[model samples]
Target: MKIPYRGVNAINSREIDKVLILSGTFGEGHQQVANAIHEATQLSLPDVESVVFDFMALGYSYLYPLSQYVYMKGIKKFPRLYGYFFQKTRKVNSFSIKLNAVLSPGMGRTLKLIQEVQPSVVVSTFPFAAGVMSKLKQYGLINIPTVTIITDYTDHSYWIHPLTDQYIVGSNMVRQALNHQGIDDSKISDTGIPIRPKFFQAHDKIELINKFGLDPDLPTILVMGGGYGIIRDGLTTFRALNALPQSIQLIIVCGHNEKLRHQVTEEFKHSKHRIYLTGYIDYIHELMAISDIMITKPGGITTSEAMAMELPMLLYNPLPGQEQDNAQFLVHAGVAMLAENLTDLKTKLLHLLFDPKLLKKMKENTRLFSKKRSTFDALDVIVQMKRQVSIPNFSVTG
Candidate 1:
């Protein structure tokens, strides 16, 4: 049996009010941002339809798996090499431009898909998709307005495309970085990272705790070990939390990692704190609502969700690329604290718990820092771009 993709068949209208969102499957952040934009469009503009497609699947059918394997393995086994390449190609220069040209793939398939979709505007949550769109526009193949949403806080040359009409970024820091990279400031909007509307909604903490059958009086700490269970030394972190002198409630979300889930379950069976173990849950907003603090990897979408929920975060062991950049930005913004190791994790967690004033300050900072209207802002950009498309037909100008 074949399954339908998300937001693909949301509308059956033949009208021109449609957004073609191109994303990738290399990481969950890109796809999640696409879905968030799709969700917001559906909720806000009933007439405008947003269709999300995994550009890798649509374009590079056979090479997708191999590329994913290489990327995941390289990040896990050879992170230094990955980070080396990341840093080397971070700035737009002669070599970085050539590197981007080589990395930009699926141009033929991208143009074909755009023609079939006939969208009013094209939005890319993935960098390569934006690259493809920009190349097509440069060649005069497609005349639609294109917007690229940078999913992470860091700026890199990979996401920069000359012919791209606009940029929707996560923060002012990234906007400034892009401007310094020679991108026009007028083309960029600091809209924050798009997340689902549910994250921005007010959830009752006591009611959520009752619904989850967790203790209401005890302070709740939500620990998220990423989508692939990639929190560094996760077992050690769990042990440190279990060893805390304060009696608290632990909500462990070991996403899509049965091995990690089983191991954590076995180890924490007789722990002092009340432990609730789950895997790949859909109710993360609910969990965030009930928690006083969250110990998580600082992925773009997750951190945005935490900030939207106004929850203080203990960012643990971020990988040495955009994740590290995100951690630094959050730490500087006063929304999160970074922990480099097991000791640092325990110490920071204790400080947040012991000092209620600090915790409250972090939560308040989140309120000031979070862009709760990010989804709508992105939707507004898409709508404006759709309205701005004036050219009737696009042709290759050789």
Candidate 2:
């Protein structure tokens, strides 16, 4: 008698197992990074089955409205309250253990995904997911290598849990910051974060422009409000871009901001040059493929993607938290430039566009900062680590 053959993942003995990826929607960076790693790992390690998870979508999905009310109201609207909680938590004795105790109940449903996946290696791009996995370990549910990727350049108190196995950080500075939080150097690697595979491929700009129906010769500037459409002074920025020479085309991506999207379209309907307006688009890789410059709010994932595209950044009105730090790093590293206010932003943009030498240098610097094989390197590490795991002599489960 012959048994049925498994499709792709079949093994004879304890083969390295699957990867369970936990992510969240607090920001696009978390989910984007998680999915990129998952995709990369899936391709690089064929034996490894990777499942991407949205932790907040578990029980919090039921209480999503209330959860959003608290998160948005606490962090975005009235951040002082959130800061108070953050500060108080930082001072707590054994904050990780205490936090695990308090949040474990709510995180029970998240562990259910892990139970279902039964992964040998679990990776999380969201900070809170690390806490949830840590809690699950205490409940004797997880025993695999649990890794966390810090999506931001700066480390936060929320990412300081001691139970986390390894950290794929964006910079050496972030690794040092983790050390300050008592995390060992052995647990951290400066991976510069992860971006989707599409960003790494080179495309002919002229061809891309022609394909998008944009003028091949025009100098293009891409403006983005992140993946959530919060471009604080974005309207004014586009208005300024509209005043530029007809040789310049401004591309505005108002992610999920329908009102802003419609408003920008109406404002630029009869424009002399061209304005590429979009709402919650997934083709940012293509947009970055053709643009000469980017005007954005300095989110880490966006910056990394821009770096991958070799696009120079012109940061505008970054937020007060990690975004501000990200802007500083970009400016300091020579990968991008910054503008203190709207007037300065307009002037800088015009100056940068007119100066070809400066633009070329910025692009070169960004390409250098962006790791050429970032996704592959991250995947290589996961595969090598999994091979070292001593599981019951078993094989991949189809």
Instruction: Write down the lDDT of every candidate, Cα atoms only.
Output: 0.86, 0.74
TM-score of every model? 0.94, 0.87
Best by TM-score: 1
Relative to the unseen true structure, what is the C-alpha lDDT of residue 73 in candidate 2, on a scale of 0 to 100?
38
Model number with the top lDDT: 1
Model 1: pairs clashing at backbone N, Cα or C within 3 Å: none
Model 1 residue runs over 4 Å out of place are: 1-13, 392-398
TM-score of candidate 2 versus the correct structure, residues matched by position: 0.87
Q: Candidate 1, residue 29: CA error in Å? A: 0.9
Q: Residue 298 deviation, candidate 2, in Å?
A: 0.9
| Candidate 2 per-residue lDDT over residues 177-270, each given as its tens digit | 7888788898887878887888888788777788888987788889997877777665676777777764678788998778878888877888
Clashing pairs in 2: 13-393, 13-394, 13-395, 14-393, 14-394, 15-394
Q: For model 1, how does the per-residue alpha-carbon lDDT over 16-101 read when each residue is reduced to its tens digit?
A: 57788998878678988998988888788998878889887866778889988787667867767777888888987888888777
The alpha-carbon lDDT assigned to residue 14 of candidate 2 equals 34
